[model samples]
Target: MAQTGTAGPASIATGPVTITEVVQSALRDYPQIHVSQEEFNASVANIRLARTAYLPRVDGLAQVNRATRNNIFGTLLPQNTIPSISGPVIGSNNGGSVWGSATGLLVSWQPFDFGLRHANVKAARAAKDKADASVQRSQLEVTTAAADAYLTLIAAKQIEKSAAAAVDNWDVLLRTIHALSSAQLRPGADESRIEAELAMARTQLVYARQADESGRATLVKFLSRTGDINTSLDTGRLLSELPPGGDEEVPFQTADHPVMAEQRANVAQSAAQLRATERSWVPQFNVEGAAYARGSGAEVDGHRLPGANGLAPTVQNYAAGVNITFPFMDFASIHAREAAQAATLRANQANEQLADKALQEQFAKAQAALRAAREVAANTPIEVKSAHMAFDQAKARYQAGLVPIDDLAQAQRLVVQAEIDDSIARLNVWRALLQFDAARGNIQPFLQAVNK
Candidate 1:
C-alpha cells in the first residue's frame, strides 16, 4: 500500500529535456552499467575454454643427465662382442653418455571421442549465446533503473513547485488581511490568523525543498557523478506536458524478455554439457612423430670407458594413423557427470519459469498503480479549486468579524493541504508512467506518446 506522492528526489537542471533523456544520460554514465558491460566481456573467456576441447593438443620434452653408474649395462653392441673387463675400476674414465638430446613433439586430435568433441562445441556455442543474452539483460536493467531515477526526480520537482505555490497563495492572503486590519476594516484577530497560516506554508515549502534536494542527490548518484547534495534543478520543462494514459492491458510475453531468454540459453548450455559428458565413452585419436639423437657408451660396475664417443644412432621415426578407443568401464563416473548436468538444466528451467511469473506480477502491479494514480489525478483539480474558494470566503468572514480567527486559519490549512494533495496526485501520474514503461520493457513509446 505504499503510495506514490508528489515528493521524490530532486529534479536535475536541463535546458529542455524529457524524462527519457535523463534516463538515457543515467544509463550511459552510471558506474553500475559499466561494471555489467565488463562482466559480459569477461564471460567470453568461458566460451574460449569450452571451444578449446576440439583443438589439437601438443607437448614437447627434453632432458640431460650426468650421474655415477653402479652396475652399468653395455650399449647396443654386436651379438658376438666379447666381454672386456677393465680391472679394479673404482672411478673409470670420463664416460658420460647423454640420452637423446631427445626433443620431440606429440600432437593429439580427438577424431571421435564418439561425439564428445561435437557436444563440447555445441555447449560452447550455447554458453556464448547465453553471454549475449546476459548483455541484453544488463542493458535492460540499467535502462530501467535510469527511468526510475528520472521519474523520482520529476516527482520531487513537482512537489517543490506545489509547495512554492502554496506559499505564494498564503503570502497574498497575509497581505490582504494585514491591509484590512490596518484600514480598521477588519478585526485584529484576522491578521494574526493569516500570519499563522503563512508560517505553516513557509514550513511546508522548506520540507518540499528538502525532498527535492534529496531527489537531486539520488539522480546525481544514479548518473555516477558527484555534485552538491543540496543542488536544485530548474525543471521548467518537466511539467510542460501531461503524460497520457499508458497501454496497461498488454499480456506478458516472455519470449522477448532478455532475462527469460538468458535463462533459456542457460538451460540449453547445460543440456549440451550433459550430452558432452555422455559422449565420454568414446576413445580419443591422435598422430605422433619423434626424432631423437644422443651420445652413448658402455660401463662396468662403477666404471666408465675412456673413449665414449660418437652420437647415439640417430633414430628419426614418424608415424601417423587412426587411433580408436572404447571405454572399458566408465559408466559410473560418466553417468554421474551427465546426471549432474541434467539436474542443473532442470533447475535453470524452473528458475526461468519463476522469473516469468515474477515479471507477470510486476506488470499487473504496475497497471494497477497506474489506474489508481489516474483516478486520484482525475479529482484533484476540482478539489483544489474548491478549497481555494472556501479559504477566500473564510478570510472575508473573519475580516467582517463574522467568524473567529481560528476558523480562518483552519480554512487556510485546508487550502494548503488540498494543494499538497493535487501536487502528489500529479507526481503519482509520472510515477505510474515510469512503472508502465518498465513493465513493457520499453519506455520510448511512452516518451513519444507524451511528446504528442
Candidate 2:
C-alpha cells in the first residue's frame, strides 16, 4: 500500500502470505486504523462546521390567530412567560373576538469578526491534522505487529525443523548403540542415554510447535481473520540473507515520525483553541435585513373588521439594520478558558518533546541490536560447521571404542543446538532490521530490501 520501492515477485507476490501482502491486508482490515480514519472524517466535518460561521443565517416564520383586539397603556418588565402585542392601545378594553396574525423573514450575517471565525477554522483544521496523524500512526503500528508476528512464526518453524532433525539423529544413534549392545560391543547404558536425549529433542519440537501456533493466533488477530493462519508464507527471502546494511547511513529524523507529528498537531490545535478563545471577548457585529407581512380583523378604534380578514396578509413592511453586542461579564469566563488552553498547549508541547526523546532512544537501541544480530549471524555458520565436525569425530571414536558414550551424546546435542542457531541467525537479523525501521517511523526500506 505505502511502498517506498519496487519489490520483486519472490517476496511480494509468490507466497500465499507475503509480508507486504499481510501488512497491506492489516492496513485495510484493522479496526484501530478504521477507527482513526472515522475520527479524521469527523474532524473534517468539524472544519466545515466551523467555516459555516462565515455564512449568512436566514429564518422564516408564519402564524395566524383569533383573539380580542384590546390593549392597555402600561410599561411592563421583560419576562418570557407572557406574550406581547405590538398594536397601539385604545382607551377602552373590549373582549369581542376577532382574528389577528403576523409573519416575517429575517437574515443575519457577520461581515467581520476581527478574525475570530478564522481562528475557529484554524482550530478545527489542526484537530483534523491530529486525527490524520493518528491514522498514520495506527497504520504503522498494525503493520509492524503483522511483520513481527510473521517473523516470529518463521523463527518457530526453523526451531521446529531443527528439533525434529535432532530427534531423528538421536533415534539413529540409539539404534546403532542398541545393535552394539546386542553384540556385546557397547554398554547397555548407552542405549538408555540416547533414548533420553531423543525424548528431549522431541519435547523441544513440541514447544516449538506450540510457539508457532500461538504466533499464528496473534497474527490472525491483526489480520482480522477468523481462522488459524493456514496460508503458506514465503520466508525464503527473510532467511536467505540479511537486509543489506546500506540503510545504516541514513540519519534518524524525528520530525517526520507519526507519533511526533500527532503531538505537534495536538500542540497546534491547543494554540488555535487559545487564539479562538482570546478573540471571543471582542464585540460581536452583524448586519441584518428582514421583510414581513401582517394582517388583523380588528380596526384601531377597537372595532372588529370583516370575517376571515386576518386569514391572509393585508399589509407588508421591510427593515434593515446593524447590531453590535458585547457581554461585559464574559471576561471572567474567557480568562478561565484561555488559562486552560494555555496549560493544554504547554502540556502538548512537553509530550512532543517526550515523544522525540523516546523515538531517539528506540532508534539507538534498535541500531545496537541490529549490529549484534549481524555479528551473531556471521558467527553461527562457523559454529554449525565446527559442531558438525565434532559430532562426526565423536561418533567415529565411539564406534571405534576410543571414547565414552557421554562424549558422543554431548557432541550430538551440541550439533542440534548449533543447527538451530544457524537456522535462526539470519531471521534474527531481519527482526532487528524490522525494529530498527519501526523506531525510525518507516518500514518501507526494510520491506524493499526483503523484496530484493
Best candidate, TM-score: 2
C-alpha RMSD for every candidate: 8.5, 4.2
Give TM per candidate: 0.76, 0.88
Give the TM-score (vs. native) of candidate 2: 0.88
List candidate 1 stretches off by more than 4 Å: 1-20, 69-100, 168-203, 222-238, 297-313, 319-334, 400-406, 424-427, 450-452
Maximum-lDDT candidate: 2
Lowest summed lDDT window (length 10), candidate 1: 1-10
> How big is the positional error of residue 9 in model 2, measured in Å on the Cα after superposition?
22
Count backbone overlaps in model 2: 0
In candidate 1, position 356 carries an lDDT of 88
